[model samples]
Target: MSRQRVVLSLISFLLSFISFSQVTTEVDTTKIRIGEQINYKIKVEADSTVLVVFPEGQTFTPLEAVEALKIDTTKKDSKFKLSRIYKLTQFDSGSYTIPRQKIIIGEKPFYTDSLRVDVGTVEVDTTKQKLYDIKPIIEVEKSSSNWWIWLLVILAALALIGFLLWWFVWREKPLTEEEEIALLPPYDRAKLALKKLDNSQYLIRSEVKEYYSELTMIIRKYLDEKVYERSLESTTDELINRLQLLKEGNQFPFSKETLHNLETILKRADLVKFAKSAPDTALIEMDRATIEKEIESVKAVLPEPTEEEKLLDQQYKEAQERKKKRTKVIITVASLVLLLVATYVGFGLKYGFKYVNDTILRDESKELLEGEWIKSAYGYPPVYIETPEVLKRVQDTLSDESKDKIKQRVFVFDDAEHLDIKIITDEVDGGEQGQEDIQRRVVQSIEKIIEEWETKNVQNIITKDDQFITPNNVEGSKTHGTADFPIKGSDETFEGEYAIFSFATKEGMIAHVTLVWAKEDSYAVDIAERIMNSIEMKSDEQANAEQESQN
Candidate 1:
């Protein structure tokens, strides 16, 4: 009996020792230099079914854990030997104790033994170390890495300076004498033309056609300058007729012999040129002499203008000069404007107009699209949609009798210009109203809205009604059309596209979403599509609850 008792006590002691040894904690070293890491390890032996969780975060108060290595597990028989290492460090040189950390094993909790650590500063041997003076900062020239940039800047500066010098200093110089002579009076110009014709070799080369053509042109040009304004544009017969009229009207004192001589020469020249009637050289010379004498006679008989006529002519010339200058200025400005517009359009087409407008023009549509969007409910049977801006509740202007029969709400997003988005909800007393009756009422409501649009000066309206299904599979009627409407405060008309979506709930409540925008606005279509796709119709109970709350 005594031996058995002693054996039983030994067995109990061994089991208790093994159970206590299941969890053990140790450190690599208790003393360390300041900021030096200490390896602290924890080991646990548990069955595969038991879960062991180590303390996480800053459980070591005085000594911070810099790193916690992943837990390593090894199977020993039916138990897992789990081990975890924590790297700890302390900056201040002092003695510190790591407090006990609570670890969880299955349902029970266990604590690790508190550890003492000494952090000491590193010792320095000052006597044995050789000291040197701090080196002075050397004054080294910094080589420029972007020399080409400076070169380009200098070249641009030189070019600008050259342009300035030419524009301000050199371009305004006076014209030379030859340039002045080129701008001579009309009489001198006619005389010069005659001299040039005489120096030509047409007559010597037996070129009668060329000679006559030049001779007739010179005479007509002289007459154009001094007498009749349309002489150059008129045929020989037309010129004679005009001259006869002028003589009969007493505008010019032309002699009968002079007119007769002039008519004979022009007719003979036309025959030589057009009919191939080659006149003899003697006859041609005689004709030329006669023409010169006739021109001199006409010059002698030319009348001087009265003082009023001279003033009018001078004023006309000055007005022509001013008009010419203004035309040149307009052409130059228009050319610059066209070039800028072309350049802008080229870039816009290449990168997309939206990109150019958003970057350069700061267009409102682009800003609205790219900006923050809001999802909100509108009207009673609230139509849920996302928009670039919040819709505002507008005043209900329906009569009190109409209001009693129908609970109507109107919300609008009006910019007072191009864009006007409105949503209308009408809850009618559907007592004894069938589906067909409800649909008919919805159609009538849409027609009434269209009539209202017409009253607002919407003309040339073209509407098409179609059945559409929402994303949630709710059936609805869509009325879309385009109309020409006058812009506010302007005579200009804008073509506007409007779409009205009428959705009738099972409870006979009609939700009408209306979108109106200028047809030219490219973003309006996208915005309208987005709003239509995002439509979510509320349930009857929710709609009734909202109505009750509103009431």
Candidate 2:
């Protein structure tokens, strides 16, 4: 009997030691006024040789850890007693759970018991606190408006337009010396050419060949313009034969003496030019005189132009002017067009063909992706996010059964073609449900939303469920995949991608953000991802505090 009693006592001692070594948690109070802190203390009794570590961080969700007080340490009979105190609070009035906290003792982990917290709203005395009317909406300028891009585009367009106008119309174009001479009448031009030849020093320098060449070219050019178009290309013998034929045919009533003088002068000029036979200065002067007299004789023999012939000549000059202007316009336009095409090709090679094509064509998705983004807050328990464009509030009609029980606000930006963004916040007027129940309902709501899409003719729905976290560390559930969406006013459907993010708060408020875009648009995909990453949840208290600080 004595041995049995000793065994029972040893077993009781072992049980008591085991209970003392285990961690225990207790809170000062489970109920508190909104924003009031609760003291949560964790106690552990262990051997002095064991190492201990208390939880540190924002792991106590729903109830935020306001501060971690220094741990209390005491020694009793070679055993150490450790107590860690945490100050926690919740800004909004709701029932929240302080999640299990990890406590490390030596190499092993121990968890503190989860605790429930009830935060009650403080009553507002409207009679004492003066009330004011709601303030009017104030417009705030966007931080990143992409004004530089627009400025660049405007400048580029103006440069191109200015260049085109200068090239085609505004520039002062002067005629060349040859063109000025060509514009003169054949007789006047021939007289001018002879005067110019007399001014030359070819004869003084004994350049007989050059002098003869210029003198003969003057007569040939005059004949080519006035009488025979091919005279300049014809040989000296051919020209003389043509003149004789024209005299015989009565085309020109040339005097025999005049023809004989012209033939003699041309043969002498040819000998001086091609045969290298240098004529004396006196003979060269006499030959020049003969050529001058022959030119006058030919002009006298030519019939005077009739009124109709004069009118035709005037019309021909006008036509030539018009042709020159038209040619200038064509050249300018063609050159500009080729320059633009070359620039486009160069940019394409440097960047990519698709990128260049999209920019040149002003693709909507590309513009939105690269344009300035707006950051704003929406709905109660506001969802803060950044987007390409500001979302406009949409009035949604609720079913008669849910009109009194549910209040919903929706904001959206939908082009019905390339991209669509919808943000929804729903507040239910009822008792707070369990977290599991809320999650289940949220999943059902997601399916219902998808079903609604199906009714709208969305097809081939493929979904993948996963967790999504925002840049601010706000976590939510996400459903994303591909689908075929119906195009407006057409029987066709386009391949598209979509993502849905659902977040629920302790106050029974649910916020959902849905994004849909064309599957082939990489720009749209980037925009969507940026929008998602920028998403953050701000409680009314936090928002109000920030606004006050800003003020």
Candidate 3:
């Protein structure tokens, strides 16, 4: 009787220890068509004070989790009942298993039983299906992007600014009165100078010395141009001696009276100027008249220009006009070049030399940064992101052996030297063993990527590893580093920075986004960062939700 009582007591204790928590797992269906959904549900019952953490991340290998629904809770007496649902799907038609998932309640861990699912392919009756011939390759014109338009606009603006600066600031002003007179022939110029002198107030102001000085200069200028080129530099006696020699030589035939009058006027004017003599108005006027008469006398004796001389003078004038035009052109061109250089320097000092050069030269990286971008999704279990330009799909031919084990899609944008971007999606044939060991696999993948770079002549690699979360809350592993990269088609190399982002799904699919840019190019760096920030994982649930909303 005592042994029976002890057994009952032990059984009660065991029952009490196991009665604190209970869990149930179920799916809406065990069978589904390809690309169809399976609603998975889990329910738990426990005390209100216990902590519970359900499974997260890509734990159900071979069956992808489309979405994790919000938890539902209710009260039953003093206990709480909690229910959680997850939407799952599969694209390939095959038999797959949903692996066991762990649930932690308070300090104890419990696991739910695994389930089996069969995804069947849709049927197609070929007899009723229409068929078409394969299309031939078509040659399409390449698009002329709007960056050229922007370049043209910038050039036009600079040109207009230069013209305005020339017009308002640096152009030649109109000639003054003296300059206009100087453009006339020597004879006409001298006559106009005398008339201007006559208009002076020398006589009215009792400026007798100035009057006599003007009287002598008028005749000296006429003699300088018509007779002797150096007449203006000669003294009074030297001029008279030169005139006498000319008369004797018959180079010029000056009358005796003309010579006498010229000699007397020059001497008197010199005395009035150097000796500071105060000459009377009558004497000043007489000297001026005599000088004018001598000019007329000299002209009468001077021989007329020969036809050859006349032709030579005309040719000389034409040459002078051409030279003036050439000088004007040179000045204008020089000024324009100077203005352009100044503008470029000013912008460089304010912004940066590289920025100005890139804008003018149409650097690929710079254009990508400033140009309009496109936002689209790539690959299945899509990666949604924005990029400066659309990436082109790469068709990779694989061997039959590789094709059976894995399928891959690659998209890329390469600028040869400055920047390169690649997106790769790979799907394995089957769920890998030890799929829960994500960190080790990720590290192996990163090392493999680095090894590939080594084959391409990338060297001196420095790396850092971190966890990255996208704007949509999708998590992935990020490996980034700096290295020396071989320039394409050349023996040269440059310092460059690189980033690789790796993401995985429960169905054994992996996606990698790799970006590389020259370290000296800030624009390329910015482009890479922007592309990284724009990345998001577009789940099947979000796509369906959007479609339903649209409907």
Candidate 4:
């Protein structure tokens, strides 16, 4: 009787343990179509205060968990029932199993039973489907909205050119009055000034002071031109002293009477002009007549120019002409350089230093950026983008057996030395596949690209991949790497950089952009970046419109 009581006590303890650790799992269906959702539920019953945790992530292989739904909780007397649900799907048609899921309740873990699922493919009636050949290459025109920018640039450039031409070539600069006077012979210049003074009515206007000033200037100028170098600039006493010394030294031929008369007239004119002393008009006339006669006398007695002096004067005139020419040349060159610098600065500020360096240094990438860029739709679900050059369509020549499985269109711009860009769009037969199948297709495309690189003798390849998203929030995958390629007909090799962007559209179109270029070509990289930034996948309506237009 005691043994039977112990057995009953042990049974009660086992039942209590089972009630405390209750956990179960169930699925709404065991079979589903590819990409069809399956509801998986886990239930746990424990004390009201016990905390329970459910398994997370893609722990269920072959069946991917799309979402972990909110946990539902219910209280029953003194116990709490917690339930967690997950939405699961399979991309490929196959038999799969959701492994046991662990549930933790207050530090102790319990597991739910495993479940099996069957994924079936959607059947397509090929007889009712229509097959179309790849569309012909459509040439897209460059954008014209930014024409005003180019127009302004051209205008600024023309203005700079015109300014340089005016400064250097087309402009006619006039000589100054002093320069014109300097061009005349000294004697002729002095005589011309005296004649001009005579034509003036200074004396007739009752201007005795003016008359004396003119009279003295005429005499001093004549003396300066014919005999004394400093006569025009020196005072009356200094001029007389210089003349006396010249005459005494026999350096110049001058009569004592002539010197005395000249000195007297100059002193009288200075006193009349500076001291405001009134002079008779008759005295001024007499002084003018005497000055004219003295000038003639001096001219008659002047020594003739020697061969050496004549040669020196000729050489001096030639030197002056050469100097003027040099000055003009310098001015022209300086103006041209200034205009060039101004133009460079204007464009540099508008574009950037990279643009300036690329243009001036003849960088290939810079040329592409500055050149005309075409915008176009390529493939079935068209990819919209801008490129430096128009992409040409390559004929698709896949075998007949595989053609029904996939349709692809390719466009390319290949400049073997600098850049190679290829755009591809593919439409696979299946549309209901999951993320894994999409990812697998992308990987296959990347591998194909790498294989093509191998055919081109590309070596030392280094690759990396990451998730990418477009400006429109469309998600994609990006694979980028570097490699070395052997130059054609040479043993030498050059470094090349490459990038591949793969995207699966909502309409089941798979599109990719593949770009490759010499690593030294910075402008090519810039072009690639611009094209990538401008990329957009066309919607169904837009794609249909494009096709209609092409048709």
In order, candidate lDDTs are 0.79, 0.83, 0.81, 0.79
Worst 10 residues of 2 by lDDT: 542-551
Candidate 2: residue 274 lDDT (0-100): 76
Considering summed lDDT, which 10 consecutive residues are worst modelled in model 4? 542-551
lDDT of 1 by residue, 1-551 (tens): 99999999999998954664477899999999988999999998876778777765445756667878778878877778889899999877989888887777887778889889999998878899877899999976544567689899979966875575456444555878666656786557656766777889988898999888888787787788788999988988999999999899998889999889889989998898889999998998888887778778878778877999999989998998789667756765665577669878998989887677666876666566655667898865568878878888887768978864676779988764666788998766433368898889898988889899888788999999998777766678889989997787887889988889888776577899888877887766667677778877755555445544643
In angstroms, how far off is 415's CA in candidate 1? Answer: 0.7
Please identify which of the two predictions, 2 or 4, would achieve the higher lDDT against the true structure. 2
- Candidate 2 C-alpha lDDT tens digits along 188-284: 9999999999999998889999898888888888788777889989987898889889989999888899878877888988887778998788999
- Which one wins on lDDT? 2
The C-alpha local distance difference test score for the whole of candidate 3 amounts to 0.81
Which regions of candidate 4 deviate over 4 angstroms? 1-183, 204-207, 248-251, 273-276, 349-354, 375-386, 390-420, 423-477, 480-499, 503-512, 516-526, 533-551
What is the full ranking by lDDT, best candidate first? 2, 3, 1, 4
Looking at candidate 3, what is the lDDT of residue 118?
98
Residue 430, candidate 3: C-alpha displacement in angstroms = 5.6
lDDT of 3 by residue, 261-367 (tens): 99998888888888987777777777777776777788889899999999999999999978977776787777779877998999999999878998899987888
Clashes (N, CA, C under 3 Å) per candidate: 0, 0, 0, 2
Pitting candidate 3 against candidate 4, the one with the higher TM-score is 3
Best of the two (1, 3) by lDDT: 3
